[model samples]
Target: MSADRGLWITLEGGDGTGKTTQAVLLAEWLRDGGREVLRTREPGGSEVGVLIRDIVLHHRGDVAPRAEALLYAADRAHHVATVVRPALERGDVVIQDRYLDSSVAYQGAGRILDPVEVRELSLWAAEGALPDLTVLLDLDPAEARCRLDSADKPFDRLEAEREEFHARVRDAFLGLAAAEPERFLVVDAAQDPESIASAVRERVAALLG
Candidate 1:
């Protein structure tokens, strides 16, 4: 809430947890309130990030855990420098789909890497930028899998991971929220879209004030 900067909000959760749906609703609501909102996501928020995203998410070949982590950090470094920071400096609300927390959860906990080292690498990559508010949409891995099956979309690398991996990711996200209560809003993704959006809006409204 610095005088020269607008808010930074991020939506985070496992696949099929409706982060996109809620991001859309939140962006629309912010726009309706006469705010300039920039909707973006990690690993594809910049042109460089798009290439990294394809390799990390779509390549059929195996990526070593440390290599994957480095790729994410590369994307984050370029993305924050070229895309996210400018929007915030211009006083635009940045509603991002994912951020460093995703790296910590997926690469660290899910992939059995050191979470602290992963976080440190991420912080170093983005020059220590953190979202002003992070909305974590929590859901069970089994239920999330069902939703993904119903969507009929091809599984990406991470989504194709075993349920146990996703469960670890979920627990990691919750732990992060618990550690940073003021910066995080943990929502039940099983709720209806409207209900979830309402909860998000309530939190965002308080921040805007």
Candidate 2:
């Protein structure tokens, strides 16, 4: 990547972990600093991705583990190509929700597939593009469940999964962060939103510098 290339930041965590909230805060912060920002998400970042998102998140049918991985990979491929890369090329900071890490956590560990294989597939799909920074909102699964329950909204397929599955996903996320410490900023999601946002901003400011 060029030194002048715009930053690519991905926020990752299990459902109700406040990835969306942090993404928004980061985007607003970047914009306040006079930076161009592109906010996007996987499985729905592009037009093609919208259709795939429906199938993967709302089909209400059994999807084989490998098949599910492939669907996510497909969305990642198109999203990075048509949405993410162009924003970076234009020197716009891209704050994305759920990148390949989610697949490695959800499909790989949660569904009992090989995390390494899932990561390799995603790398191939995105032509080896990795985020400049990945913010992981670490939270207990039970706390996340309680938050989701309080929302009283419909659960997407992933959110509706059992607690054990979510536990696996959280562990996988922590493992990924440990393996790539330089690229990850893990925060306690149980913190007040302002505190979490402050931590994220501090790390992001360093990158911007």
Candidate 3:
């Protein structure tokens, strides 16, 4: 890492939690404050990651949970080496839409992968790296689902499953937040976007200090 290397902050949440929107805003907020910030998202951040994302998110058939997890991890490994770590080494504030915790929550707990197995693989995927702060926008699974209109893309093989699956993912995210209060913060995302953004700004500002 460079002498003036920066911190990594990530935004995480279920499908309807507005992570995509907020990540953009947060990066802009930091830039406006004169901070060097790089904003990106997972499943597709680099060239390699984009290839992996096509297979994972739009695959025709149902993929096994373990296979899905590995795919996500692979993309993450490339993403970290190519994008995240490099930006951090350059002292740029790296804020991503999702990171390691998403894998643990969506694949490990939501899909019922052996927790221990996933954790070990997560370490490898991340190469022992972690974000300094993870903001999880928590919302009820059903409420979140309702936010996605037909204007949105059709559900993927993973999303075609029962609502129970997403409920599990939500619970898993909450559990992760509970386990790491300092590193993870869960904000109620059922609220208005502005309200959620306000809370996100406040928390991020505090952490950057």
Candidate 4:
């Protein structure tokens, strides 16, 4: 929000909670409202990010928790510096699919690392760039798994993790939102996509005001 930069909004949730769907919807809605919006996602938001994303999310074998965290931090560093920051500087609203919170939730909670440490690592890696608003789509892990099953796509490395892992991730997201009420809009993802998008639009509109 410094220097009157364009608003940076991020979508976050457990797997299959419709983050991608909502990110697209939010970006579309913002554009309809006459804003130039840049839609992107973590771990693959830049030319360098694609490789990092594959390793962290699609690699065939186990990645040590610390190593995995480092990969994400590396991607985030490149992404925020090259893609997100520049877009915001140009006065383009950025609707991002994930941010440091994901690392805190997934790598920290899900991977059993200290959430605070993971958060600090990500913040340091990205030079402390944070979103103006983070929309957290809260969902039950069982419901999220069902939704993923219905999608019928091969699960990514993280998505293929046990239900317990996802539950931890979900809880971490909620905890993060609770701690930063002003920066996070906690939405019930069980609702229909249209309804969820409407709620997001309303919150973002208020922010814009």
Error of 1 at 82 (Å): 0.6
Q: 80-169, model 2: which lDDT tens digit per residue?
A: 999999999999899999999999999999999999999999999999999999999999999999999999999999999999999999
List runs of model 3 lying over 4 Å from the truth: 1-4
User: Residue by residue across 95-159, what tens digits does model 1's lDDT show?
Assistant: 99999999999999999999999999999999999999999999999999999999998999999
- Decide which is better by TM-score, 1 or 3: 1
Worst 10 residues of 3 by lDDT: 1-10
2 against 4, candidate with superior lDDT: 2
lDDT score, candidate 2, position 23: 87
Q: For model 4, how does the per-residue alpha-carbon lDDT over 1-209 read when each residue is reduced to its tens digit?
A: 12245999999999999999998898888878788889999989998999999899898988999999999999999999999999998988999999999999999999999989999999999898999999999999999999999999999999999989999999999999999999999999999999999999998888887
In candidate 3, what are the lDDT values of residues 1-209, reduced to their tens digit? 12255888989888878888888888788888878888888889999998988998898877888888899889988999999998988889988988878888888878888766786797798799989889999988887778864438797666665789888888988988999999987889988888888888887777667
In order of appearance, the predictions have TM-scores of 0.97, 0.97, 0.93, 0.97
Worst 10 residues of 2 by lDDT: 1-10
Total backbone collisions for each predicted model: 0, 0, 1, 0
In candidate 4, residue 59 scores what lDDT?
88
lDDT of 1: 0.94
